[model samples]
Target chain A: MPSVKFIEHNGTEHVVDGTNGDSLMMIATSNLVPGIDADCGGECSCATCHVLVDASWVDKLAPATETEESMLDLNPDRESNSRLSCQIPMSDELDGIVINLPEFQY
Target chain B: MTNIVIIGGGQAAGQAVASLRQEGFEGKIDLIGEEPSLPYQRPPLSKAYLSGALEASKLLVRPEKFYQDRDVATHLGSPVKHISPQERTVTVGETEFSYDKLLIATGGRPRKLTLPGSDLSGIHYLRTLQDVDNIRAHMATAKNLCIVGGGYIGLEVASVAVTLGVTVNVLEMESRILQRVTTPFMSDFYHQLHTERGVHIHTETTCQGFRGQSGKVSHVLCGNQEIEADLVIVGIGIIPNIELAETAGLACDNGILVDDHCKTSDDNIFAAGDCTNHPNALLNRRLRLESVPNAMDQARTAATNMLGGDKTYATVPWFWSDQYDLKLQMLGFSQDADAAVLRGDPGTRQFAQFYLSEGKIIAVDAVNSPKEFMVAKQLHGVAVSPEDLANLDVDLKSLVPST
Candidate 1:
């Protein structure tokens, strides 16, 4: 199990145990971490699960699909490391990955 | 603190409440839903929830604690009887609630076929969770399921029923399945897919009525042909719930007419979700959409403008459907597209059909190709030749300029 840290826009942090094969959005949302509203249920169609990954771990994670990048493009607070958390599947290698929730997804 | 009343406890209303709180609005929020449950996600009602793959608790759009902690007054099972814009009050049963600003997110209701033998016990329409719960209970003993529409709901139910080892038959009034929404090529693909899965599809078939055994639906009567069925699911379409807005003297044309800000004829009254027909600057027309994304986006826009922010709703509409391991994602509208450029081979079950008009991309329907659909969504109004779009060798990502 990998431990992922999710930091909200208000600077609130939530550390949750990420099981292999589960999405980051799924882990945060199932664990009651605020700000990760996966309204589309891990579907890449909606950008509600957007997260700004820390630059240190950006290269370590899998590259975002064109669909994920398109959703991230819609985010008002999108950064270079912005990614839809649903596209990021959890794995042991991603243990200690830090992500920041945007102020708003729209 | 100003009082805001939002009608219909569905996606739009839920998003409105969250958007208001996120905007730091400390006001009274009264969420009135006709259903017994709190604001829940209806998309999964036909998929996971219908098949029992997902638990009832997972259907909740937000945790129950969020509403309580936010002080949202949720009136479940309480249907608003009337709305008086002059009095600025909404009447739910015997109670009347006053509001400084009101949002009409009443959404829409499933349209039913009005013909002989329409009233039967086993005939169902997919809308609320209670409706699906009823259908699921009947599915336990149901062996043959007759779907009266080839739309999303009807096809989704067919998918679930076939998976349950139930014989499925889809009756579509149109020439082909999904004719109203998708191109012929896309429709043919689905038609073949469903046929290969042991599901029978009847196209250009109009069901006149239903016959029942002991008041339970037993067979469907089409124009001279009778199709045997133990259960029937109707998914023809939905009619917008604009009675409240119409009664209030607000402009009503197909739906509650709202401005770009989502405000109705009455300044203090607004509407969102599938209930409101508003102008889409992006599509260059007025449209009413029934997708979850459309509801959420318009709700946030309505919330912002209600809070003194001068914002307009102009996002490209997108929709999706899941069936038998295939996800069909679409963006924009293909109403007037002159040509459809096929990307990738449909034989692999992973391809995209881009609708283009005079060389400018207008819309795309991607089957199990989320990446192509996402890229096409970003290039909504961009002019791209069909030649480049057809070539899979051309990286679609490079076509979109970095912001």
Candidate 2:
């Protein structure tokens, strides 16, 4: 059972169990995480399910696809580590992954 | 001690609960819905659910425990029969509940075409999970499927039906497919896409009546031409659910009239989603949009205003549709654009059409081009050189004037 830590903008943290093969967006949304609004329901169309991965854990995660990069590019607030959570799936090697919720899900 | 009542069970109602709790509203929340299932996304009903690729449980907008933990008293499978604005009470089924504030997120229903012999048993409208389930059951036996209206819903269903080895015939009353929502280029693009994939498209064909055998629809009579259809699905359009507001004496026109703040005629009541014709500050028009993004954004704004916050929902409207291997994403809507610019060749299966008015990007239609769609949302209403937009060498990011 892998786990993911979601840190809100206000410094509050939520550690929830993540099942293997489910996207990070599904895990955060299923657990009622407040900040990540997966409005498109895992469709890469809407970039609302945005999260900035922890700098230490950034390289450990799968790289964002070209489509995801294009979607993330237009955002004025997008950081270098910013990725749509829906594009990342959970895995055993990525256990205890730490991700930060952006101030707004634009 | 505060009581907030939300009427509707779609994404708007579901998101309203999340928004309310996140905004720190420590009060009683009641959500009354006509559907038995919790709030779910309707987009998948046409694509995945119809093709048996996705299950029924996956359609929910949020998990069930999310609402239960927040203590949202959801009255599923029951409609709000009456709303008394003066008393701030809504009658759900047999129970009467008083509210300090109320939200009418009652979305909309499919607009049915009433022609001769339309009461046939095989006729259906793609709106709910039950509708898709029933249609899927028919698809198992249906050989010739006829889809009325060549809009997004109709074309999406056609793609699925054709993929399932069922012969699909799309009948559109308009001169071209997707005429109501898109420009000629994109409509023609979809027309070619569907035809190339083995779909029979009948444009400018008006269905006059339906004829059935054994009480099930078997044929569609279009003027002098008759279309033989073993199964029929109508995707014409939708009618907003504004009867409650109208009965309660709220202002109504094309839809329940609301301001950018999602406030109705009565300050105590707010309306969101497809049911309300809200004014968009960016578009500067009062329009009723039937997109999931619009519904969620408006619901959040209404929740904030209901909790005494002064937030407004004026975000640029955007929508997406999937059919076969193509994904169409659109931002903004204007059919009366004086200038339409094309970026990339449509024959390449990846292109974008920009609709400009007064030299500003008013609307855009992007097919299989996510990069253009993403840039279009940020540059909505911004004036750009049409030459720069048509030039492929210049990066679209550069065209987006640096703020």
Task: Compare the candidates by TM-score and give the number of the best one.
Answer: 2
Instruction: Write the residue-wise lDDT of candidate 1 on B67-124 in tens digits.
Output: 8878999999998889998899999999999999998999999998888899988998
lDDT of model number 2: 0.89
Report how far residue B189 has shifted in candidate 2, in Å.
Answer: 1.0
Q: True contacts preserved, each candidate?
A: 0.14, 0.68
Candidate 2 backbone overlaps, count: 0
| RMSD after CA superposition, every candidate | 3.7, 1.8
Q: Which TM-score value belongs to model 1?
A: 0.90
lDDT of each: 0.86, 0.89
- Listed in order, the DockQ scores are 0.25, 0.63
Instruction: Name the candidate that leads on DockQ.
Output: 2
Q: Which pairs in model 1 have colliding backbones?
A: none
